[model samples]
Structures are given as structure tokens and as C-alpha cells.
Target: MTDAILRMRGITKTFPGVNALADVDLTVRRGEIHAICGENGAGKSTLMKVLSGVYPHGSYEGEIHFGGEPCRFTGIHDSERHGIVIIHQELALCPQLSIAENIFLGNERAGRGGGADASGRARHGRGRGGLGRLLPGLRLVDWNRTNHEAARLLERVGLPENPVTPIADLGVGKQQLVEIAKALSKRVRLLILDEPTAALNDEDSAHLLDLVRGLRDEGITSLIISHKLNEVLAIADSVSILRDGRMIETLDPSAGTVTEDRIIAGMVGRDLEHRFPPHEPRIGEEVLRIEDWTVHSPARHDRAVVSGAALRLRRGEIVGLAGLMGAGRTELAMSVFGRSYGTGISGRLYKDGKPIEARSVREAIRHGIAYATEDRKRYGLNLIEDVKRNVSAAGLDRLARRGWVNGHEEYRVAEEYRTGLNVKAPSVLSETGKLSGGNQQKVVLAKWIFTDPDVLILDEPTRGIDVGAKYEIYSIINRLADEGKAILLISSELPELLGMCDRIYTMAAGRITAEVPRAEATQERLMSHMTKEQEQVG
Candidate 1:
């Protein structure tokens, strides 16, 4: 008999003015790593939310079967009772809490009493012996046991961090490991990870995939939603394609039928001939140059975050920065952009053979430089505002007359960008927060592009976006470069760097380690330079 751990039959989910999912069916075998691939807004995350009880039992029409028993989960806690845990793309850990505290935050173990008096149990909001069975001791948390268990879980996830470390102090990769460890603590049977490796680098992503493989070997089932096709192909036993809120097909990679091209065809509903737009940069004189740039840490005065980082970008040239996480690429970019990030920043920025003063964001914009921040939701856009406001946010002066915003001009600018970037929205009046990842990124680009900058810095431009959206963004980048705008691109994906950049610079330990021309750059060579500092330390 075929072993099936979970099944969803004829699932139909709908939201206002949108049918997100329609009569979709999915089955995951026991102890297997199943991958879900789709274009952005294809209902991947929505489906996972339904499976994990985020949408509740009666909200969506579907039959969800787990372990041969139909499940009607009313809430997340209900799903957790059945050993189903979901780690979302946006992490849910409290930054101020320590690792142990965050892991056992809601599910804490009790002390040595084993059971408590009726009055004691009532005081702690527990039924008859609820505290005794769940915690062993009533109203008393066991820190020793908590730390010991937390340490073990961390070790299993291959994270080298103390249990007492604050979540805010940890990097994005380590935070992801902690999320997995939290899931492990819950006796998870079917773990759902949505874009777990989206924020991670090559080494960290590799380690996470290894952990997933080990879990599969240990008979734990995983359902991963990812945009990185290579990772999905590498780790998943079976791959399911989703397009426009419908199931396309599921392929077994071991049967030699699964390829990136085939998957792209399924996702886009077309055989995409090329993953990237052909880059034929028309080289020109140097447009932007930085000399001996250095920035100190914001938290620590003595620590240097970026030191002696120097680079140059010419008109119509797209230059890429490749490095591991925490390699200071983002920091360098932010520091240069009006010192928006680090403290004690010392950098000499030259534009078109002349030194420019960009001590603040206003001056930076005035100097014809624009920065599309990495954390778009946090820094790039006002989520509560409409698309019209967000598009003119960076260049409000252009839409103002006599210290007053010209409403018609603002709408005109936003509509031009909205239509120009092909952002899928009802109108310029639509809320920016309501758009999907790909559309949101396009809006961010529209905001910066509206500023009419001569030089643009894009940080992780395609992060958390689907393949189709990535191709669109790449086309926009190529278009901008062709227009003689100097572009500085930073990306975690090596293939993206190799495909889009004319020259690639490698960063390690806050310094530029090597600069490779496009003709000589490869993944292996870039990675070698990226980890040189760690190798030297070892």
C-alpha cells in the first residue's frame, strides 16, 4: 500500500475579489521532503496557511487528512496538538527573548512537584491535572531543564549559539535555525517551512537543506515552499508545481523528468527560453566612485563594520557584490547612501569626476543617487499608504508647487510608474501593502526610479520573489542599465550575479577581497574569495 501522511482534496479558498485557490488537490507521502513551487501570488502561502490552521476549519472548503484521520483544526494550537508546525517566511520569534525563553515561551515545563493542589491548579488557569501532566510541577518553570533541552535542539539543527543568547543578537541564518529548533520541540510530524532559506546565504542554506535531509532520514515529513528552484531540486524527493492558484503537476526527480526548464515551463505556462535577459551593457566613463570607505558599527564605537571598501561603477554598467551573510555588503551600501546605517562613517563619494556631498538622505537624492533598501517593508514603503503616495515619496518635491502637493501631478507620476513597471494593482489608489512580493518590489523600484537618479543601488532586489517576478525585475534592471544609469547590484544568489553583472566584487570580513571581470567570474571562484577570511582564521 502507498504511504500517505497528509492529503488535501478539492481545496477551494477565496478572498474578496479574488479566488485564491480552486479545487486543488495535494498528497504528501510519509517521511518525504515535498517541495511546492510557484510564481508569486500563486496561492502557495495561502495553501500552507490552510493546512496549518491559520485559515481555520470552516473558512476554506477542503478535506484535510493526516495520519489516515480527517482533521478539522480550528486554530494553530489545534494543528500543533496534531504535531503540525509551520515556520513562516517572516519569523515569529520575540527579539528581546533569549533562545530558551523563545523556544518554550508558551509551552514551558514545570518543576519537581509532579502535581499541584486543586486550588494551586485553579490559580494557574489549569484544569484538574493539566499542569501536572503537561509541566509536572504547577506554576513553577524549570529553567535548568529548559536550557538543557534548548541546547540539544540547537545542536541538532547545527547552530552554534548559546541558549541564553537573545534572538535580536543572532543573525538571520541563526534565527532560522532557532525556528526549526522550536518546531522540533513541539514533536512535529509534518513541518511546513515557507521560504526558510530565503534570507540565508549559500553556506547557511546548504546547512539547512542538510538538516532537512537528515530529518527525512529520521522519518519526519517536510513541506517546503521556496522560490529557489535549485534548492528545491536538490533536496526534495517530489516537486509540485502551482500556477495561478491551481495545481499544475507533480514530478519525481529520481525519474529524470524534472529539470529547471521544465519547472519554469510549468510555473509560467510557457517554455522560457532564457532565465535572464541578455546583458549587453554599453560601457561609458566612470559615473560613481568611492575611495577607502570605512564605517564603524552603530552599537560599538571601536568595531569597524566596513573598512577600506572601494569600488567604482560606470555609466550603463551593472556591477555586482557577492559575499556570505554578514560580509558587510549591505552595510557598505547603506553607509554610502547618506550614512543611513552605520555610525562614524567616513567615505568619499565622487559622481562624474566631482566630489558630492551626501551627508543625509535629502542630499543623497539631490546628488542624483537613489538607494532601494533591502528591507522594503520596513524602510522602502509606507504600507498603510496608497501606491500613489509611495511612488512620489522619494521625490515629493517634483509633485509639489509652492509648498503644496499637486494632487493631479502626484497621481500622474504614480500612474506612469504603476503602468510602466507593470505592477498588478487595481489602480494607483490601491494600498501598497495589499500587493504580492513581486508587485511590492516593482513598486519599490518605481519609487526609486521616479526620483530620476543617475546612480542606483539595489540591495537583494529579488528577495522572496518568484522566478517570473525575478525575470521581470531583471528586465527592468537591464533596461535601466541600457539607459546609461550606473547600477550597483547586491545579491545572495551567485547565478544571478554571474548572469546580470559585467564585473563582480567579492567581500569577506568587511573588506573587498577580490574583483573579478564577468569573463572570469564563476560560482566557485566567487565563493572561494567570499570565505577566504574564515579559511585564514581556521
Candidate 2:
């Protein structure tokens, strides 16, 4: 085997009150795909951040070796200069810019050659510099060269679209491709993808895996961090497991020895008997129903983002809404929850066979309905606040007396949820932003549950969390259903929907194409309807 391209020895990172990493070690070979798997709060992302210089050299105690040479990177730009690029879980793309502009955003062709106008040609001896040189000076950008190069990179990533297209018009999967293309433009030798397929659909994720393999064949090393054990076992040449910020073991799946169960055991320190908890559903009368619901795009009034969609949630029932990216499942949920999203919304919402007026967020809560947004970091939690404040944010009225919050009551309420949800935090005073993805999600759930809503709309509840955390969240959902709270689960993972939902609704192109019961629902059956495009009738 070739020598290690990247190595870290005796790495340790500490926060104010937490020792996030303790005596960690990792080694990655050249031109191989290495995957890091762990439970939430296991320090996977923190380790990567340290490597990529987001934490910098002095911030953490560690020794890093790249290409057999000790290196101390002071910042992300310094790491990028050495042919290392990182694509974070949350995409970092500017929605207002065109594809070509976004690709070459920071690294413009300003000082590079090729970007010259006609006026600059006559100024600095035009023919003196020959080809590849700009004609002296032109402050304006060369759109032609920029778009042409961007198109080549876009094609290389298998994205078929015009380079002039606005980023806002593209879906999440396409946005991910753009992120990869941007990384390629940086001439990256070692690419680090953190939860690359966390939000992708089945087809898009497969294509991405194929692309990663192709990159490996082309001699580019990759370090992927994912919660999906199957993908890690399938694509990684070596798998490294982390638990509570410590290195567990590294396994090579090509030896035909390691399995998903083994990896799960390593992550959680024990065997997991089942993925989903047992549930005895007692579905009763309908709690919430939407009829002929339609929502127009907030960006374009002429465009209808969701078209003629209808769904129902009965008491004590867990229903799944399955679809690919841009399928409008989120839009449907948001629009119904007090018209939080979309303009020109037309819908009829009935609770207990009677129409309810949910014209605003306050009214929506009053009507006993709650919606958890898919983008938790953005809309779900006040990241800067402590867990206690965030947990009680949704139901502040319950802890308020004469419009003033009662401190003791608030603390008691937050502590109850902190213990009940099994949130991994030192105390309720822990910052919401400082917690890991799974704990943050639990806090979001706590906030909504405090509202005591009879109907809950959970969108991508376990999108980026690890398997152990996912199981816990699933158990919580089952417990909620057992308590007669109606749940509408929106997920991109078909297996999750099939495993946890009593009935599944397949949506495509903003429409509910098919509805299948648990007895008949499968990934294949749901996917068939999910990818079915709306027929054009002239």
C-alpha cells in the first residue's frame, strides 16, 4: 500500500466545558476514499473542521501531516492553497448569482490572463504578450471565458444546464453539483465532503457516489463523512468509526468481513435489535384534512409550486410524505401551517370535520397544528440562545404570567424536556448552536411539543443525523403517535417512510400522485410515483 497522504496523531480538541476530542488518530491513504462514521456529538465534523483550518492551528492540540510533511494551516484559505477543499453539509452557494458567476466568485480572472476588452488591446503593445495573456488591463470581467470554463466544469459533474441560469431556479440536487464544480475549479487534490448525500434523493445520491468513484479512479483522494452506513460500506476503501470524540477502529469492507451491524455496534457501543420501535397505532377520526390545496411560488406569481394536493392525518396516525427534491412536500406543509410559505395560497383545512382559521402562526398553534421546518439551522431554532430558552420559545405563553416569563417555571419545563428527550448536553444552559445536529433536532422537537399540538408536521426529521440518533427520533415519533398526536412525516429516505409510517403519500411535481398503505408500500413503488412527471395535455 502507498504511504499515508494525511495523518493526525494524538489529536484533542476542547470547548468551554467539553472535551470534544481526546487522543484521536486518523490516517488516509493517497487516491483512496476514506469514510468517517459516527453518532451525533461524536466530533466527526469538529475533526474535519480542525483539519480544514476552520479551527486553525493554535485552537486545537494536534499534529497534522499532509503528503509526508508536517503542516500548520492557519485558515481555510491556507488549506485551500495546498490543494485541499471542503464542501460543507449546508451548501454555500449564492442564490442571486448565475452559475458561471458563482463558480468563479472569489477567484476571479482579474489578474489572470485571458480577460481583456478591445480598449485594453491598444494600450500595452497588443501583440507583445501573445496568447493566454490579457490585453494589458480591462476592469470589466470577461463573461465569455467565464461561462465557457464554467460550462466545462458543469458538464464534468454531469449537470445539464445553462451556465447563465440563476442558482435560485435550481433544485437542491443541482445546487450540490454546483458545489462540487466549485471545488473542482480550485484544483483540489484532496476533497473533503461532509454529509454529501444527507439531503439527496436516491437517484441523485447514486449518481454522486458514481462520481466520487470516478474521481478516485482519476487519482483524487476523498474523505467522506456520512451517517449512512450502507454508503460508507459500499464506497469507502476504509471506514473509520468515531464515538464520543474518540477513534474506535478502522475497518476495510473489501475484505468481506465488516457489516452494517458491526459498524452500528461500534458507533453506539452495543447491538441494536431493531431500526424502528414497536408501535401499536389506534387511529381514530380525522384530526386534520386539506382539500384541493394549491400554493403559488413566492418568487414567481405566475408559477404554482404546489398544485391540487390533498392529504389527511387522523388521530394517532403517522403518515409519510415521500418525494424527491423539489417535489413540494415542504411547500405543502408550510403553506397549510398558517400560510407560512407561498403566495396566492388556496386551500381548505379541516380539523375534526370543521374548517379552522389558521391565517397566522399564532392561529396555527391555536388550532393545535405545528410544522417543523426542514432547514433547522435557519428557521427551527434560535441558535445563539441557550437550550432552556429555545425549548420554551414556542410555548412561552404557558410559562408567562401577566406577559412576563416565570423563570422557575421555564427552567422546570426545559429540564423536563432535556431529561425526557435524552438530549446530550451538560445542562439546559448549553447553547443550542454548540450542540450537535441530533441534539439540535431534539431541541426543535421540544419547542414544538411544548405547544401541545394535536397535529405535527415533521419535515426531514432525521436528514443529517447518524443511525443511533435516527432510531431515537423514530422512537420519539412512535411515542407521540401512541399519545394520539397525528404526525405527517416528510422524508427523502424511502426506507424511513416505509418503516415508520402507517400510510405513505407519493408526491411529484407538486402533486400527490399516489397513496399507498404500509402493507403495500415499498421503495420501488414509492419511487415509481415520485419520479412520474406531470403529463402535458395540449
Candidate 3:
């Protein structure tokens, strides 16, 4: 028998009108970190889903050998039985549940059975249907044992949270650790992490990476699906490049110094000379300005989410908002747009030197302003709907004749953007849920663009997109700026803001600490301002 712990041969999966995976092969040694890299629509997630039995045995053509045994897993539970567990990009944790409960939600520990059942089980351990004596109905949860085991698993993943604490209280980074703990609960041998650190900050990402390395030392085989190439080159012992639903090639980074440029070439099938499209900014007159903006949290009306913030946007200019995850960048944008968030909002909005009120989302759109949400799937687009509906979501009135909508016009408008934005979908009729993260972002851009807004507020526009798709988005932003739209770009990545914005503002503790021109902004300088201590002001 070979030393490999897992081998997938001739894996092919197809969707309606889409061949998601075709003849893909992957081999993982007993203990190694293997990374899968590709563009957004590539078969990275699809391949992992096949292995974890999300596609199941009969749905795809593949032969999977695990731990020297030919395996046929019919469901996620079956794969878990074989020690395969996959943590998806969007985490599957219930916010209301405690860490321990979430970890063992499906797989629970039970107390001793009833006297009758116990006696029967003692007589015949395998009961009537050959199912175990511990029936779910008679299974009372052993909370003390559950919490104790959960703590052990949490320690293994380096999470220091109380197992009984609600998952909602933890940050995204900590929540990820809880997910790993949940995987360890299953005694997982083959762990698959999809975009593990996509939502993490630099510190948290480093911590997560270190934890993964620790897991490898413990003899666990990990397969990571990520668009971040630098991460792939850093940790992956073997790197597999997938493109257009076919296996291109696999390389060993440990053999030599494998550059990010090389990985990009394999992913996009071309030398991506520039991360951002070249642009010369043409900043015109001020189009939108905010004065003394303050917003209180809707839940707790006394707590201020944004305070005394002032900002300005000029036509043909792209201004970047630089802040950490909870630095009120989004709060400020949403409040200023239409007071969409928070209570007790006190703000002065100006358009072309005239004071204006945009107290609602509809009024904001009517005022020629648009805001693309940070969480696109949650607040931006209707995922179940088709491309045409999502594309023309914000500007339905443009396609509407009085009270009725013109479906043909909506399709025409969506098609125009689909071609212009280069969105990779089967057609305008295709469900938005089926589109990749990058393409879905384009559709969100199309929705806002269709509104013909003079001011565009983009929140983390390229959050989970690959480098190639990021370049395309940058080009789109530049084009929009060139078309004389005042753009406010909000991003967590300092480099993205530096590369794309003409002017950048750093926020700390619900306040704008500093404004740096493009000529002066650097990661270090931005970080200094972003980390500045805020005054205890309301």
C-alpha cells in the first residue's frame, strides 16, 4: 500500500449547464498541508465538496481511497465517519448556541438509558433494527461531560474561550477556532478549510496559520481552498492549481522559492503584471460632504456607533476609508447614505453646497447616492433571484412603467452589465446564488451603477475575490471615477486602499483620526493613525 493517506482519482462533477469539475486528481500524504488556488469560479470549493460527500457518491464520478481503504461516503456524516470534515468559507455556527453546544450540536453525548431499555440493551446490545441501545429519544444530554470534552478540543485549537459562552460574543477569528474545535470533536484526520483566513486581520491570520501548522505536527492532513496566494505559498507543502474546472498542475513550494507571480500565472493563465490597473486621478469639485455626523446604536440608543465624523467626496475622485474591522467605517457610510443604521442620528449632509436630508434608503437613491454593503450575500443581493433581478435591484424604477415592471428591459440592462463587467454566469436567467463571490460582487456593482449615482460608497468591494478578479474590480472603480462619480472606497486591506484611492482617511474608535493624500499614505503611516487613541467623547 502507498504512504498517502488520501487519494482522489478521476473526480468529475457537473451542474446544470456547468462542468464544475472534470477529471481532477488530488493526493495527500499522511500529514501535510495541501492548498488549492484558483480564480473565483474555479473548482476549488466544488472539489472539496466532493471529497467531504457534499456531492455524495452517486452524484459524481470519483474513486476515493482513505487510510488504505476504498471509501464510498454517501453524506457528510458518512465522510465524518471516515474522519473527513470540511469547514466552509461561510461558517456554519449557530450564533445563539454556546461553543460546546455548537461543537456537538449533531453529535451529542447521552446519559445512561432507562431501566427497561438498559436491561434490554444488556440482554441484546444491538437492539431490534441492529441500531445501538442508545436511542435518541432516551438519550439525555450529559452537559458536564460535553463541556469538559469541548474544553479539551478548544485547547487543541488554541482557543481560550469558555465552552459554555455563546458563539455570538466571539469575533470572527475566535469563531473560526471554535469551528476547528468542532472538527477535532469528530476526531478529524482529513481537515478541509475553505478560505480559512479570508475574514481575519493580520494578527488573527498569523495566529490561525500557526494553529494549522501545529495541527500538521499532530499528524493531521489539511487541504486549504484559498484565493490568497501568499498564504498558499507560505504553508502549503504541495500547491494544486485549478482553472476553468480542470486540473492544471501541482507544484511543491518546499522544493524552492515559489513566487506569488508564478501562482498568479497558473491561476489566471497569464502574467498579471499589475495588481491594480494603472490610473491617473482627475479630482474635480466636491460633490458630497458630511458635517458633525453622529449615530447611536439602534439596539442601545445611548451607545454611539459613530461620533462627530466629517468627510467629503469630490467628483472624479476615489477616497479610501482605512480602518480595522469595527472602526465605524461601515457605520459612517450607512448612516451618511440614508441613516440606514443606528438611532438618534445627527448629521448634516451636503450636495453641491446645499444641505439635504436622506432619512431613508429610497431617499438616498433619489438623492443620487448609492452604498454597496460589506456583507453582499446578507444585505446586498437576493441570492435565489436571477442575474437580471439582482442587476436592476436598485433601479427597478428605471425598468418600471408606473406600477408594473418591464421584464424585457430588465433583461436588456442586466445583459449590458453582464457583458461590460465580464461577469461569468451561464446567462441573465442564472441564479445569483450559483455565481462566484467575485461575479456576485460585480452584480452588486451593476445594481448600484444602474441607479446612476453621482456618489458611490463601496464597502470591502474585493473581500473574498482572487487577485485576477481584484484587478478587474480596480479597473471598474477607475472607470467609474473617470466617469465623474465621486467614489468612497472602504477596505480592510491597507495595500488595496493605497493602490486605488487618491485620498485616504484613517478611523479609530468611531472617529476619523487623520486624512492622508495618496502621495503620503503608506501602510505604516495609516496604521499609526488607525491605532490612535480616541477621545472619550460622545
Candidate 4:
């Protein structure tokens, strides 16, 4: 028997005008946690999709060897049948279903001969035409048995005891644990996790990493794909780097040579002297100010998402709101921007020196405020629309003459922003959905920039984008600040906050707990504020 449990040789995949993967090779040892690191568009997800049968057999050129046997997977079900399961970057559970139901969705057991396996056999045995042959069949599903099995799987993945709980009630971290439990329920041998901790807080991320280590000890091999270098350094046994669809190199993490800087250099193909550009703080007059901003949740409960939050932004300054998930950073931004989210919002806004009221999104735009959402796909861009339409969506009123849009004017504006932002697409007529994640984010930025807002609220601006693209975004942000635009940047990455913002406000439990200037901000200090627990109200 071979030492390696999984191997891919000469893998190559292509899309229209793009080579997603080129002659890539990978080998996974038995019971080891291997990591794949790359920037966005670096072919990590594409390679995993091929392994998990999302690309299937004939679509890509590659040979997959599992347990020393050559295998061809036709679909995800084919891979799952052979104990090779992949958990995607996005969790794939039905929000309304219970944990037990989701875990045994396709693999259910029936009494005697009537469950999923039995139904298949019964259907095949119908041709035999014997009542006695099917007489012993039982079709009733036992809830007790299903719950027992699901509980075991959940325990293995370190989830709390709640098999009957709906997935929607859980946080992203716990929901990720449910995904791991679902994978383990299939008795998987080779498990793949793509950006497992991307949205998780530090404590939750550490717990998930510990679970991965435990899985390795129990003889389950793993392949992890992530951009966070620190987590890679902590959990990986060996690491592989990919650049522009080609395998750069694989290094042993234990060899004392695979530093975070080394891996970054390999991914980007250059030494980064400074991840953030230098800024000259010529912060001018106050551009935006909010006082006693409070927004209630849309749910029945009168929970305040943004509780008495107040802040100010100066022209030519980038201020960051640093917080863990659910800390109301995005909520505060959205609520202030034309009451787009939340209700019972009461806030006083001042533009320049005079007080103004923004009752709707259009009103907010009229007052020179623009908000770029974290979820660019859902809230920012119309995926079916072309680049020209998306860029001019915000300022369509200005582009119209006698209630009719001027196509020439629209195209001219889009062309100018596309060129300025360096958006890489075939043409402005290309569908927004067809672009890469990085470029899609750029289009969102372009749309908001077209609004010509005096104050811009960017929520997680670089989320899900690649390192190279993130650098471009960072540069763009600095240029905006240099051009005297006040930016409120909200991000989970401490380094990014420190690198770009002149001042950082640390939020915890829907309140700003601490404020730190750029010169005094450190990862340790910022994290201290982020994790500080709020006192329970009586």
C-alpha cells in the first residue's frame, strides 16, 4: 500500500479566456492536515472543486488517485460515496432544518428494510414480482436513532448538545461546526475545508483549529484552504503555494523555513516592503458627524443593533471601526445611510457644520453619503447587469434626460471609472457575475465612487478578495483619503485597520469600547478591546 492516501497529477482546468489551474500536482499523506495557500483567483478553490467532483471527470484534465486506486468522480454524490467530502467556503445547510435532519439528509435509515438504502433495493426488486420478497420491508424512519447518530457526530466536531436546534439560530462559528459534523457523518476519510475560519472570531477559530488537530490524530486526513497566514502556521503540517494557476512550491511547516513572510512572498512572487502605503495626515474639517445613533433590530424583539453610537469623520482621513462579528459595525453604517436597515433609529447627523435629516436611501445620497456593503453580491451589485449599468446605478437620476437614460453619457462615465479602477474584464458590457471576486468588489467601489459622496462607509472592503487585489484596494482607499474624501472603514483584520486608518474605534457588544490612534494601535491592544465582554443588564 502507498503511504499517500490521495494524489492528483498534472491537473489542468480552463474557463473562457482564463486558465484556472495549470499542471498542478498535490499529494496528501494518510492522517495528515495539509494546507493550500494562495491569493484570490489563485486556483485553490478550483483544485478543490475538481477533487470533490464539482467539475466532474471529463471537464478537467487530471488524474485522481485515492487509496492507491485511480478514481473518476462524476459528481459530489460520487465523491461522498467513497468517503471523500468537501465543506465549501459557504455553509450548505438548510436554515430551517434541524441539525439531525441536515446531517442525514441523503443517508437516512428506515426500520427493517424501508430507509433510503431499502427504498432503492425495493424499487429494483419490483421487477421480481414477489410480495413475500417485499413483505419484510419497513419504511418508517426512527427519530431516536437519527438523533443518536447526529449527536455523536456533533460531539466529534465539538458542538454543544443541541441536535434539535435549527441551523439559523446558531452563529457563523457554530454553523461551521455543524458543517464539519455533516461531513464527518458520511464517515469521510479525506475531508476538505475551504476558508473554514474566514468569518470566525479568534476564540472560535482557535477551537476549530483544535478540532482539526484532533481529527488528524483520529486518522482522518484533511486539506485546508485559507488566506490567513497565522492560522496556516499554527495548524498545517505542510503547505503548498499557488500563483496564477501554477503550483509555486510546497514546504514543510516544521522545517523552520516556512515563515508567514516566506509564504506571502511565494504567493505574490515579490517581497512586500509595505503592505500599506504611507499617509500624510492633513485631516481637514469634519465632513460627517453622528450623535446618539440608535437602531432597533427588525425582529419582534426590540434589540438595539446600534446602541447610542456616535462618531465623526474628518476630510482626508480614514477611520476604522474594528470589531468581531455581530458587534454592530455594519449595522451602524447601514442605519445611518438612509435608514437602510434597522428601525426606531434616532440619530442626529451633521454635514459640514449644519444638521441634516436623511429619511431614505435617496435622501442619504442627496446628502452626499454612500455605503458599500460587505456582501457585494447580494446588496451592492446586480449580478445579471453589465459593468456599465452597475457603475451608473447609484447616479442614474443625473444620467437621465426627460426621464430617459442617455446611453452615451452612461458608457462614458463607466469607461472612465473602469479605466481608473483598473477593472480587468473583456469589456464594460460583460456581465457582473462573470467577473472574479476581486473585480466584482472593484465594481461595487466604482458604483459608490460614482455617487461622489463626501463621506463613504466601506464595510469589510477587502473581504473574500485576493492579496494582490487587496493591495490595489488599499491603494485606492489611500488615494481617496488623499483626495480629501472622509472614509469610515470597517474591517475584521487588525493589520488592515492599523495600516490604513488614522484612528480606530474598537466595538464590542453593540458599543464602542475603546478608541486608539494609529500610532498607538497594536494587534494585542485592539484584540483586547474586541474580546472584552459586556456586563449583563438586570
For candidate 4, list the clashing residue pairs, or say none: 40-466, 114-138
- 181 Cα displacement, candidate 1 (Å): 1.6
Summarize candidate 2's per-residue lDDT along 430-491 as a digit string, tens digits. 99998888899999999999999999999999988888889989999998998999999999
Candidates arranged by lDDT, highest first = 1, 2, 3, 4
Best by TM-score: 1
> Each prediction's Cα lDDT score?
0.89, 0.88, 0.88, 0.87
For model 4, residues 380-419, the per-residue Cα lDDT tens digits are 9999999999999999998998999999999999999888
Backbone clashes counted, model 2: 0
TM-score of each: 0.93, 0.89, 0.91, 0.92
Model 1, global lDDT: 0.89
Cα distance off (Å), candidate 3, residue 124: 25
Which ranges of candidate 2 are over 4 A from the true structure?
A: 112-147, 161-166, 533-538
Error of 3 at 428 (Å): 2.0
Off by over 4 Å in 4: 112-138, 533-538
In candidate 2, residue 453 scores what lDDT? Answer: 97
Best to worst by TM-score, what's the order? Answer: 1, 4, 3, 2
- The C-alpha local distance difference test score for the whole of candidate 3 amounts to 0.88
Query: Per-residue lDDT of 230-315 in model 3, one digit per residue for the tens?
Result: 78888999998999998999998988967889898999999988878999988899999988898999888988878898889999
Minimum summed lDDT over a 10-residue window in model 3 is located at: 114-123
Candidate 4: C-alpha RMSD after superposition: 4.4
